[model samples]
Target: MHEMAIAEGVLDIALDYAKQNDAKCIREIGLLIGDMSGVVVDSLTFSFDMIAKGTLAEGAEIKVKHVPLVGRCTKCGKDFRIEHYDFWCPECKDGVLKIVSGREMQVEYLEVD
Candidate 1:
């Protein structure tokens, strides 16, 4: 599954940081997942448990921070929360809404010993 790859990548990054910093062990990993990032949180967590085996991040706790999808209206310069596939502007009821945030999946922090 793609989530396995994503989880492996996350561990790879955390290990790289640990190696660079000479950390003996990793306590936790933090991630920021945006609503529009197309990542399944449950799958990611499960894959992390599998792929983190024997790595520096083995037994490390994963913390995910969910970010809401936010869109900016092109016509009226307004911003609004987007639910599902609807991209219309909330303030002006316009169709020219551009995505300003969300659509992100990244490691935000790491707790190490």
Candidate 2:
């Protein structure tokens, strides 16, 4: 699965950072994943667990923060939260929407000892 690759990347970053800081071990990993990021949390967690073995983050707790979809109306310049995959603007109703959030996949921080 693609989650394996994703997990490998995350593990690489965490290990590199831990080595740089001379950490004994990783305690926690904070991730920010948006609704539109197309990543399944459960799958990612499982992949991470499998990939992190024998590493500094072997027993680290992964915390995922979900971000809701948000969009900005191009015509009216109004920002609103998107629900149910609707991309239309509520105010002007004819404006094209540009997604402002809910498409990100990033590591927020790592708690290392």
Candidate 3:
């Protein structure tokens, strides 16, 4: 799955950072997941658990932070967070919307010991 690749990339970055910092082990990994990023949280976690064995992140805690889908209405100057995939403007009920956020998945912070 794509999550496996994403997890591997994240682990690679974390491992490199840990080694550069001379960390003995990783305590936790803080990840920010956007709603539109298409990265399944559960899949990512499963992949992480599977690949983390024998690595510096073994047994490390994973903190996933979900980012809301924030969008700006094209018809009206309104910004809102949407839980559903409907991109319609809440106020105007228009289908035109400009996504402001919720399209990113990145490692925000890493806790190492």
lDDT of each: 0.89, 0.92, 0.91
The pairs that clash in candidate 3 are: none
Write model 2 residue lDDT over 20-76, tens digit each, in one string. 999999999999999998999999999999889999999899999998999999999
TM-score for model 3? 0.89
| Candidate with best lDDT | 2
TM-score, per-candidate, Cα-based: 0.93, 0.97, 0.89
Clashing pairs in 1: none
Which is better, 1 or 3, measured by TM-score? 1
Best by TM-score: 2
In candidate 1, how many Å is residue 43 off?
Answer: 1.2
In terms of lDDT, model 1 sits at 0.89
